[model samples]
Target: MTDQWVSFSKVGDAELVSLTGEIDLANSGEIGKAIVGRIKESGKVLIDLTTVSFLDSAGVRLLDALVGDLLGHGARTRLVVGERGAARMTLTLCAFREDVLTTDLERAAADLK
Candidate 1:
């Protein structure tokens, strides 16, 4: 498996987390930790999953946990998913909230503001 990487940056008041490669059992916990850490740093976060090549059940669980954590902290999170991919499928199959999912990066960033 190709090692997954999560890069962090900022867009207005929202932190942008860009995930690349794949997310599975090996790295989902690490990924979740990174995302939670960012949320603790910034109250708002936008997770960009456009470049993520794959996401398994572990990955989906990671995302779900992040969302729950953010809610508990009263922070906001927006997910920018690719138009098509494992990431998108996982979100869909899990019936994630449509209002929080989008394919347009610019729009997602703007909405965060």
Candidate 2:
């Protein structure tokens, strides 16, 4: 269920979801679903993509939907994307909101406040 590619942790008051390796059509759905389940009961969430090696349209869509869902629930949420990662490049190309993207885990958690 994408366990090999996805991992979870607690970052301050935020539930952190980290991804490694590629996030393409084959595993994006599973990863997204799993993350949704994780943050459903959380008050804040952080999506960390610093270690993600690759991303595609599916991954972008998943992030969009995830952020939308979290916002809808009034949950504080942020994304952790290193300045030079594939995930960051893809998200930038897709015009993903910069207000939600950051490069530090602690900063992301602080932003949730």
TM-score per candidate = 0.88, 0.95
lDDT tens per residue, model 1, 4-93: 479888888788888887888989888777766656857788889988888888988888888777767877778899689878888899
Error of 1 at 55 (Å): 0.5
Estimate every model's Cα lDDT from 0 to 1.
Answer: 0.81, 0.89
Lowest lDDT block of 10, candidate 1: 1-10
lDDT of 1: 0.81
Question: Lowest-lDDT window of 10 residues in candidate 2?
Answer: 32-41
Clashing pairs in 1: none
In terms of TM-score, which candidate is strongest? 2
Candidate 1 wrongly placed segments (more than 4 Å):
1-4
Top candidate when judged by lDDT against the true structure: 2
Q: How would you encode candidate 2's per-residue C-alpha lDDT over 3-110 as one tens digit per residue? A: 889899997777989899999999988998888877798889998899999999999999999998898888888999987989999999999999899988888888
